[model samples]
Target: MTTGNIKPTKEKKSRKSKPVVNEKSPLLPTKHEEDAAGFDEFNGASFSGAVFNLSTTIVGAGIMALPATMKVLGLIPGIALIIFTAFLTDASIELLLRFSRSSKSVSYGGLMGDTFGKYGRMLLQICVLVNNVGVLIVYMIIIGDVLSGTTSSGIHHPGVLEGWFGVHWWNGRTSILLITTLAVFAPLASLKRIDSLKFTSALSVALAVVFLVITVGITVFKLFSGTVLMPRLFPDVHDLASFFKLFTVVPVLVTAYICHYNVHSIDNELEDNTQIKAVVRTSLTLCSSVYVMTSLFGFLLFGDGTLDDVLSNFDSNLGIPFGSMLNDAVRISYAAHLMLVFPIVFYPLRLNLDGLLFPSARPLTSDNARFALLSTSLIGLIFLGANFIPSIWDAFQFTGATAAVCIGFIFPAAVTLRLVNLISNLICHQLSFCHLKESRFQFSLK
Candidate 1:
């Protein structure tokens, strides 16, 4: 045969496999460069461990204000909203995971970048900074309230330290918060990874349980002793302004369940990454149970006397055995639990702040100077905010209405709306997954 008669073969180009993964595959993993194997020393976190961390994130500072919301919405509406928020949170997180998997995006900021642009991601970082800072400030304020006491409505609710040792310069609000900042918060926040706080998260959850058990005990004792009466099951609305006050309770409820910011971080660390859904369901179920019990019984115990910080209501004499002791126990245990929860919140705050300031820089844990500067600067700012802020309700409302709402609901909805056509079939096929669209729709109408 002549050489010219042989057809030229088109060579198959050898292509490299990109790191991006398809959702249909089993792993469904979208990891950051720093998270790749041999990059970080730590391995992935266990399912139980991830649940504890996420639960701590959800159950922080917000729980204190839930009873106040009950005062506004009443028990029936309050409990209903709480459960609804849990289901909604589960739905939102599911949407987040689905979008993340489709785009092969790892972090929340990264997901935003994929959906909107760099500016969108930057906006998310700013919102996170505002929300988490507001949250941590509330934590510090509650700690100050519990350990050093808060003065509200012409009544002085004495802190545990004051009751135990009387007020000293060292035991004053400023001193107690400073000492806690240096001793408890500083050490924990300085840690590098979310998974590292697993033990502390477990301890924090247990301490919350301690508070719940004590509240239930006191409520039951008073109920059985015929010393207590059920509070209003539905909110009382008399006038136009009174009706609007019901809307004010929305932020408190939103803040109570605003754990979306930490979802990606927790999912990234899970050893069995697909179990992220289960971890979320488990965490929300546990947290919603805790929130309901706390709201119902805390309101029952206090009734019309419930203060913005329910812990403040605990300062008064309960008609029970060793009432002061029980009061002290509840406040002290909760304060300590907040100390543990501080780092879980602080971890994401620091990460986002660093992302905002140093987008092109290396990983946060890799740079000692950047990590220290951000950590101290944030703690100092929050400490100042706690001291200056007059009310926890004000902080919760401000953060929840603005940053928390955006972080929790708006951005995710925007992301989904931007690309709804792409994955319409994927979402429509799974009836269980339809909750996100339904929940978000209900949320907007609300």
Candidate 2:
């Protein structure tokens, strides 16, 4: 029986043996299948590890600014905005995951590529680069502030480093940042996968909790002692400028919850990828509680005097129990937390850059030399940025308004909507084809 003379019934049997697209859920792929394709590395992270990593990413320098946001928007609105931003952030991440599953994309850049082609990928990469770099620079600035105190109006508040080294040139912001970047951040950033940073992420979260505890303790003590200043529930809105500037808090709050960039990266690390939504929800809820406590207590402690950086509100002159000791502890602990956070944010940045610069090269995670060079170059840029940028608030505002908004809000929504349209069209086409086949059969019978 030559193949050319095979019976039509046998040919039909062969066709029927092939896999049918409609038989499988379009968005859900089996774990073994994705693993065999090398799209994800299994057993990389546990549920707690993923949650810790994501919580650390979400609750960085942004929380320090939330008290200041309360000063601008007043207590009620600020708290409301924080909760609202968390909700929106959660929604956006859900969209990303939905689209990512449908497309089988392993990274944000890949998702964009799948949805909008090369230009879309490039756009997302650019946004990640800008947002992450700006954030890292802000981290450096806060670290510098804590380690080498800021001088305002000829009075010097001693930084932890400055206090230890007595105003020496080597103890300056530039020197401290350089030493820390080389000694600390570079090594952490060099880790290949985000899951490896789980231990450090846990430590960072602990330190953040410590900072929150100290703030809450101080606020409660001050309240009992009749020393705490109460913040207004609503802003006074004395002028048009002040009223309009109320909108500015939106971007800051948005930036506070800007962990959308790393959602897929963390998802890729999970041992059970099906747990991503649970991980996201848990992380966001934890971060929201932390933000609320930090902002509420921070605002209560400082009231309208809250600086753009809440850590700045702590001074040795506060005369609370262990006032000076608490100051150093809060600053050092939070700065250290930021140190751990730098690597988490950098993970996605490096991933996106690799996709842009070496699209055809092997995965950077698997390429030692390329990963080293990329990490070094990015840290160097951030190093220079930290040295020059005088204010983190400015950096946060610019990046938050542009890149953060696009990545956190616009891209996910657009991609998910596009996927919906594609699925709708496919269903419509399938139904039309089936109707036509039935019509032809009916006509033949007649």
Candidate 3:
């Protein structure tokens, strides 16, 4: 929960990470302290924390557009692509764990710095900053939709500081931003531990699951009831090229899968490294399964048509419920999710910025620091791009190429080589150092 100034080593500029527990610097925590923080209060996170980290990492606004992604890739290839992406991501995660074992550091940014250098750390900072902004834009759009729908439903929009000002004022956009700032960012900023929000994270995952199940049910119902109107649920050879194009869908999904950054915080709370791995594996598997099923069924039912939300995407011919009520439900649920997700992304943005620019500053202790950084970011987003939220898929493509692939693919390979070199030179003492030589071989193949 409390990071406790666990800084990554800065002495190594070579693309080779020095193991953290080497004899030169033997002050590293014992195996128990290395596994987790030794503080009584912040020793380990609950199962709820694991679920929260997993769910928050996995769920993105991308679920809304998965139908479109599937349409682009077609059926069989689309499924294959998703599976392949999952496997690739899993491998990267395992490599990250191996790197953690070698370096004895748990944070993703720290691991990256250990593996690469100052430049790599800066690159990760930029990636997290951009990704966080993208997420903010999404929440803005989602909040706007919710506000619009709520105002239209024979209810007045919530006014800001009405009691303080002794007057009523209503602006949908401003209201949403104010509420988001107060309800989401305020709590997130005050928190010292990322694991504290595990409950909300678990709730979000559950909600996503419910949404998926409802979508699959609707899809199956539509199919069986003979009201299904989409193209046949089958692949077309002509769509093969487009299937590769669908790789654009990987970034945000990868972002949604990014749990490494928070691993340090989680590890501090965990007693057993094996338990942590088990939890991580279970959470990722469950989240991915839900996402894949939801995407597949939504596409099967709706085909290429617009599926802003899975529930509302169904055709008009298949009567299910009151249109207005369902629309409101979908909008409200989405809005709630966006709000819950804001902190998860926002804190990382704050941490990365602080780490890169003002590594010594404590934004947590200073109100001025928090407001200056967060408000400036939010205002810039509102002024620059809140009105036209960029395409999620396009954003994902850019993020995948820059952040996901680099962090997931390149960093892991680098660390593995560094670890092999450390082990071979120190433990085995082989004159030829065949293992060290083979490290580069694996890196090249990767």
Candidate 4:
């Protein structure tokens, strides 16, 4: 070896020692293998889980008030508007997929940041914050109503609250709110993953199915038995202004069907982002079918002039167990559901809040911190809107108009266009680089 090459000398080591990491960082899963698994396992959800998530998020507390929305728009046009909104919603989803791919980041906030920069992110975060807050307020109001024995406004028959068990707490809406808040927030505070809410999500879907069966079955039975006659066939459309007035229903329908935020969660859980397209398409199609069927059955059974929140259409003492049973079932389902759903809404809320005030403490782990934040937010919402329940629906409409339309429709398209643009730029850059190399070679040879 010495004959062929020179030997190397030993090197001296430095006196300094490397510093050791005192606090170990949490372990992150190493492999991407799990993501490639089945759609059912990606989000730690089954097929039923997907269905339940879709149904619960889409239905929410809004369904009870749908009759009032339909009443404003009339039957045919109301149905048409529902269809139109569905189309808008579908288009938005398709667009979001493209944007997600181009952005190369998971979740809606990331995609938004890629497209519109900081302002875009801020705007989207604000919209999400408002929507979540709106929903929380709505939930509180609902719990208050149920606890205080108040019927949905039009469902306000005189003796309806008299027979309810909790009617004794008639003036105790504040105590009711506090109790419900604690119940709803406690589990949410402990939840590690929002997606883990699959159980309650499934329960929500079951409740919807149960309600649907009862509502449709009872309506059909009533129709066949001739106990309840159908209402007017078609309302007279005097002018275009009357037709334009139908736009009033747009807010409620938009709010009811809004599930765009759910898409972000679906993507996060998905093994392959491509599956998101499938899930969203499937979910939207299912939701639209449900809405159309439910709306039609609702209008035909209760007639065109039904009030917002369909519960109002029936007589207070409507000797039907279907109504009462459905009410109790839904109450249970949603009550359980709020336990799960609250975290989904709260995660984004906390994210936004962290970004706004406590920039350094983004990933908050302290349970006390979470509890305090939630309590403050909930209390603030109640204080602002406690006396304004009558106008909550109106607020919902405005929130839906901005958040639902943009998040559901516009953002998706913008995202898709951004992805397509990225792909085109990448291709052009490669082609230009190749052409420049060729031109240089020819010039040198010449």
Candidate 5:
């Protein structure tokens, strides 16, 4: 009956469609939309996967040195600093996530670029490169130590391979590292997305847990058997120089929690982006607990005599059941864990390098040859550094004091302050504008 009136309804629908078309008529998506697509490839990671990956990143070779840090800072201060670093780390990452979401920056470099311009981006990239390289070198060094053992003062302590097979060409540090790089690490590093390595990350975390459990178990066994050494609750300060030296441990603690750079990347991969904060909190909490337990028990097992590398402490024969077997298990398992961790750390390093060198190019993950070459070169350099470097502690100190501090603490704080300033300025400008408009209206009425 009123088919003519139906024409008005159709016209009304057409008019409504015009505004919808205009609303979305932009030539490009918004920054957040772009970020969503940019992050689409690796968005398969679950909350648990992000937690495990992040936990693995936080609890790396640093844990082995923590007991030594505890030795320097003593039990109370050392434990305090560990928790303190975790808190700062959580806060800093929350800053990172907040800024990341606001700016729609997916990577650390991208965030720096948005905040501090191109040079800021370069600085972040440099820091990440130095820090990740140092980490990879430490991983290789530990792997070499585990597989081929080390010699000091004309005494030879056999590594797992040497202990198992005696002195052989194949069990040599160089040989073992080469074999490992070629056989295991290179292949893993070739993976395109961080989410793809979640299984390995989980395995790495499990191995670290195994290492921690072994340390705690050994310490407990020795304690109940009345063989455990009493660790100092405070450092023995002799001279002012010695007292000041305690501050050195702070850098190591800072470095231990230097997962800030990867937080954005992990956040981007979350199945639900809103869960980033929860994932970060869970990861930092888990890593902090693991670090405290490992360091406390390791120190209890070794006391002031604890070596910078806790694994070295195990070199001396422990008179327990399967002592030698347990020793090898901890060493080998941790080394393997470091091997798995190498790729995760390397992931961001490679991405940063790609962004720096080939900013306009397609994603490295999409460019097979470039990714392979980049991985090979970086890993090769790391292998050389590992061979040449005498101590992971020294590497940790340099990277921690410089790059780790900058990336983990300084940058996040600076960015947050910048954002706050911008927001304050905007609010003030809005208020000023309103006041001016009100004054103008009053004058006009008068």
Candidate 6:
């Protein structure tokens, strides 16, 4: 992840991407890459920057739900599912990248529009709208949950501010979330580029690591002290219903990896688009590692006591010295992490929403007023939803999860399977053309 020494050169921009295999080879710089245009904006993002943005996309509220998933599926199956999902996610993204390059589409929506029709593009857009906005709203709610405690069973849990400074008008949920939106989310979201959030994305990933580190530390301490016993490594199944219930984690697993929408954007902005596949691999590797460790240690620490949202589980006494302080640290750090993640998610949401509504309009970046209108509208909608309609979060997550399945797994697989022969023929034609062009150049030199 260290990016200090490995500098990417951008001053000598190339009109065409380097061949994928070799200069003598005719496999890549496929029709799409040959026609790919460089952005005239700021220099493209360094490799690490792209990795951070994409990793942020993949690791959202879903990470908090992973520990709970492990509780249901057990460590063995749980870890297996995580790894398997990561692989599937990798393949799905690969499909999107491959088909996108072959089809000459720049965005996910465009790819869909190319592969299918306008209706297909519209479907992907709607799904992204639901998924990203729901995720952003839930992020706001989680922040509120951390900074201003939530109530359940007629008991009110204390938030960091409430516990420390006592409840005040300023520390109320709406007040705190509003301040957070203005102070953190607004400026980051306002940036015109996804790579602009690179540093914040890196920090966000670091905060996630902070949470993971603390969780592992607490678990290790408890293990050595012989206070917390080893948890079950398999699901405790008895009834037929119990056996069927294990499938419920599928949604969580799928949602954990639904980042296909933003793949093209990141790839679009990379200094070298060819490195996008490597970026995907690195991001997935880093995120999946965090996910596996978090699931394992978090399940070990809380065991049966783990809640659907494990952040809530942090409110209780954790049977260690300075446990209360560590609890606050974990919650607050992750809250801040989500704050950073806001913009990375918001970027694609804005892009897709714009493309959905204004398909024929100029590029969003070139149209300042259009960009502002979309950004403000989306943020306002999310802010109001976080404060007013929090009850629908469950429903939103369900529908969003469904849409995410389509964006991540279903659509990519369909594009690949349905158009295999077409792509093969396209590749053959491109290859023959490349071979002929190479021969003419050689003959001319002779």
RMSD in Å for all candidates = 11.2, 8.2, 10.8, 10.1, 7.0, 8.4
Candidate 4 per-residue lDDT over residues 76-141, each given as its tens digit: 776777778778877776676565555444456656766666577667767766776776666555
lDDT at 398, model 2: 90
- Candidate 5, overall lDDT? 0.80
Best by lDDT: 1
lDDT of 2 at 51: 97
Q: Candidate 2 residues 99-169, lDDT tens each? A: 77677665666677778877887888898899989998999988888888875445555688776668798
In terms of TM-score, which candidate is strongest?
5
Assess candidate 1 and give its TM-score to the true structure.
0.87
Q: Model 5 off-target regions past 4 Å?
A: 1-43, 152-156
**Evaluation by TM-score, superior candidate among 4 and 5:** 5
TM-score of each: 0.87, 0.88, 0.73, 0.76, 0.90, 0.85
User: Which scores higher on TM-score, 1 or 6?
Assistant: 1
lDDT per residue (tens digit) for residues 1-446 in model 5: 55755643321112112111110111111233333343222224577998988988888889888999988988998999899889989888888878876886666666777777778877888888998999889888888877898764466667888878889999999999999999988999988667778999999999999999998899899999999867899888999999899878877898898887777666655666667788888988899999999989999998877777788667678889999989988898898899899888988888777766775565555677887788888989998998899877888888888999998999999888988898999999999999999999999999
TM-score of candidate 5 relative to the true fold: 0.90
> How much is the lDDT of residue 59 in candidate 5?
85
Prediction 4 global C-alpha lDDT: 0.57
> How many clashes in candidate 3?
4
How many steric clashes between backbone atoms does each model show? 0, 0, 4, 11, 0, 0
Whole-model lDDT for model 3 versus the true structure?
Answer: 0.57
Better of 1 and 5 by lDDT: 1
Residue-wise C-alpha lDDT for candidate 6, range 298-415, written one tens digit per residue: 9889898776677878888888999999999999999999999999888778877876777655567677899889998999999998886543236335744588789888889878
What alpha-carbon RMSD in Å does predicted model 6 have with respect to the real structure? Answer: 8.4
